[model samples]
Target chain A: MKRLIFCLAVLVLALAARPAPLFAQAGGPLRLEITEGVIEPMPIAVAPFLSGTANAGELAARISAVVVADLAGSGLFRAIPAEAQIAQVTSFDAPVRFADWKAINAQALVTGTVERTGADRVAVSFRLFDVFAGAPLGDGMRFEASEASWRRLAHKVADTVYQRLTGEPGYFDSRIAFVSETGPKNARRKRLALMDQDGANLRYLTGDMSIVLAPRFSPDGRQILYTSYESGLPRAYLLDLETLGQRPIDNQAGVATFAPRFSPDGLQVVYSLERGGNTDIHITSLVTGQTQRLTETPAIETAPDFSPDGRQIVFESDRSGTQQIYVMPAAGGPAQRISAGQGRYGTPVWSPRGDRIAFTKQQAGRFHIGVMRTDGTGERLLTASFLDEGPSWAPNGRLLIFTRVSQGEAGAPSLYTVDVTGRNLRAIATPDFASDPTWSPLLP
Target chain B: MPIRRSILTVAMLGLLAACGQNAPYGNTPPPGFGGGVPTDAVDVSVFGAGVTDTVLFPVDTWELTDAATATLTAQAAWFTRNPQATAVIEGHADERGTREYNIGLSARRANSVVEFLVLNGVAPSRLTTIPYGKDRPLEICSDEACYARNRRAVTVVAGSVDLGS
Candidate 1:
């Protein structure tokens, strides 16, 4: 028996010593996991693509520049300037000089080539390399689009590069709809404005004839639901982005409806309706024009937002004697309060990843922009100031854009974006004071 | 001559007292634009000018405070004097809370005012509530004083009396 036991022990030790066959380490490239929280931006070098034709050279350079900007704006990767590059990528299929990148301490290298496919058409092919591993990070890919869509093609390349490194979707191709404010502080003129996620290609969807508020995009990014005070009463209006056409909702004559948001499926809109001195959340189906009251409580219930899966809704309610965040079934049921902190939590928006909820909190006379787990744990305040309200999550769910107001009369609310980890707080440049920003999903 | 003048002055004073007693009050509609009161017109009286139109509330609470109740009580008296008048109660909040949540809070504040006025004999049908949240601010300052004024409910009267001013 002793001899048998010794043999079994030896077998077990040998099995442990050998690595698991299923967990075999592939020999290709070194990849880093881009987890939540702060870390030094990985240094990357994106070489200007070698154009297949002489006329495509300028277009190639422009595309490369856009890719650099998109990656830098993410606060995840720092692109080394062309002046810092030790080696030039003259050919698409040629091998990368790992030693040259190593000399510059670049962890990642990107090389691409562009070719003109037709009049107003182009094809962009790129590859990402792990400088240390001396191998391609993933399979190379090609994107084709019209020359007018060059910016979009560049955004696509950046998205793929970001996904290759971070293992997450990129929000570089998204858009935002916000209320643009100008004039004096009191009688400010506000119009609905839309722009690319990087604050380019700005377009005014509505004139300054009326006050617009809380413009939220549909899931497909083709339409927006906003509240306008055109009839001298706050009412919800649906605007089509492609046509720039709009119409008021069929709310009852005496009732005021506002704070509109699109349902996950974009088949209905959930908004607040004030009637007979009481405010309640009402869902109106776009197909049937049928309005259903979600909450009938005397306490005000507004700001209803849907979960990513459309199975649940997260909204704010004052039924508990104070403003608190709550989640309920999408079909309307008993709501569970998710915010337990002492502060007044409101404007609770569920993250696109369905992992967290972002909100604005007011406590002790100060306001803060914060995020919490879906179940109300792991609360983190990303920003605190005299005023920071109305947080809208980026399409990637990794960042939030909110309205931040300065102190005093001159302190108008401006658009600002912050990373989920409380770092990279930056202001989004707008021509005027902006507020109630809603980010669109990745463009088609 | 002194006795005749005293008699004429007493007669004039009696006539004035009778006119005051006969003025339209209670459930009777004022004799102006017939019985139909235009709902679209904005009447700034009952709660405007000499009368207090707005009652302020504390942060995050919709319950009427002592000061708010006092102002609304006077407002209720004005409503009593003008029974035919209808009102649109506009509720507002300061820039402290989320825009959507503040809408709810403002709705509650306006509802509280409506309830108090109803309990003080204002007809329920004569009031409509609209909550503007933090979208509309009476004072643009960011201090507590401005915020205090911002968190308010204003009763704008509407009736056949042509009280546009």
Candidate 2:
């Protein structure tokens, strides 16, 4: 008996001496596990879009509302309601009176002038001012857009102002490609709806063709990747904007696919596949259906995002006994836990800048928006409120925009934004409840 | 305010336990002072048994108030005494704004708490964060009071914060 026990103990010790497997060491050295959020929101103001007569098509009146919507939707600025706009500068050509704006306690101010250069051409020029410092921080390029391009022009203006204030590129001038809902949750009218970031200029790309979720924009803002319940099963689909083109990403079946995002170069799509009650992140080429599994985690893993270099992937998994962010090589290897905290974390989105990852965290029955360094250090929670999730980073990587839904009395879904510093809280303009927002990169 | 006071009282006791001094869990300060609210002890009658859609937030902004700050302060002190404790502070907002922006706003709220603890001498290495942009809820009520409560950061004990003392 003593001889047998000695042999068993020796065997156990040998097993324990082996190195940890490769799949367990993939996430880079930096990891940010956030444990707190800011108590106050920084204040900012977005001016109405400037307009003038001889307009391309109701030119002057429409742009202001669009600007308001863009700024508000970001949740980083407060659109000084036309009612409380301390002073209205008539045109971009006119000098701005910083005192008037500052008097209303506006920390930041925007002003613009619109000029009709020709029958089909209009130029819009805007300037952003720091109310606290009473100086012009930046000015936007003149947009000589046609009447039909008026809305886009306003977005560009807002984008410029946003970039100036937030010190990052603006996503306001971009578009939100989401599924427009017109029916009940069980049986919904699912169409690929493309609208301005402010919920204006709404158009349908996939005219009620299928049920879709997790719409992601192509890096250049030309196409989208979404999960469709078409063909009698859920699969990934890509839609082209210019021609309203549609193509099946892959013939995934038996197990459905969901939560898809494109690489920075648009060469690949990363998504989740439900196989026998377990989900894992998978990657496939845009040209060919050939796939490479990025996460071997047996537990559910969804919402995979690629690092800017496309060399690594950050995803959420329950391999650690709870849902948390994990990282592995883009080719799929050992996974490292980026989030090692208690509450469940999911919906991980890699920032465009590659310095951080944004994700949703649930703890003690509440959820929040948070970011952490690539290694999981410096974990900081940026926002907290009822039902805040689905973080989409602006092109600049300095600002984060996400959705907020109110339940019970003031229950409604709306968009909000904040800087990485946790300042500049504002709302985006919307006519109804909206969620699942994706920010587009700056247009050419 | 009185309810918040009650919450503060409980939070203080909880924070005290999480503090580096109070050894509720064990001797090696739990990771992050990552002390979390014991959901197992939540009363069904006061805050409701199951999760509801309702929440509460302060007026004009999403910042936690003085009372709220006091509660967090206690949490910070507890973090000082514990070494292994880790936590994820989650921020939230009411349903008044758009969803995308609220995610960032709520994240800022959570980050502030992390910053507070760090400023109070809590090690920055022990914290981790992730933001949930309006995907989860705590209450079913949508009134101002409910919204006030909803717009907050939940402390999540990650790793070995619960030492099973």
Number of the top lDDT candidate: 1
TM-scores for chain A over all candidates: 0.92, 0.75
Tens digits of per-residue lDDT for model 2, A75-138: 5555667778768776666767878887787766766667788777777777777675666775
Q: What proportion of the true contacts does each candidate reproduce?
A: 0.53, 0.10
Task: Kindly report the interface RMSD of candidate 1, rounded to 1 decimal.
Answer: 9.1
Best by TM-score: 1
Q: Which parts of model 1 have CA positions greater than 4 angstroms off?
A: A1-28, B1-49, B65-87, B113-127, B157-165
Cα lDDT tens digits, model 1, A1-444, are 999999999988876665321111267345445545235677889988879776999999999999999998888888999999989988899888899998998888889988999999999999998887777888999999998888888889999988887778898888899999986665567899999888888889987756679999999999999988676567899999999898876558877788888888999888888776577888889999998888878777888899999898888888888888999888788999999988888888999999999999989888999999999999999999988988999999989999998888887989999999888888999988899999999999
DockQ of each: 0.25, 0.04
Error of 1 at B54 (Å): 2.6
Tens-digit lDDT string for candidate 1 (B10-30): 543443343232222111222
TM-score of each: 0.84, 0.59
Task: Output the worst ten-in-a-row residue range by lDDT, candidate 1 chain A.
Answer: A19-28
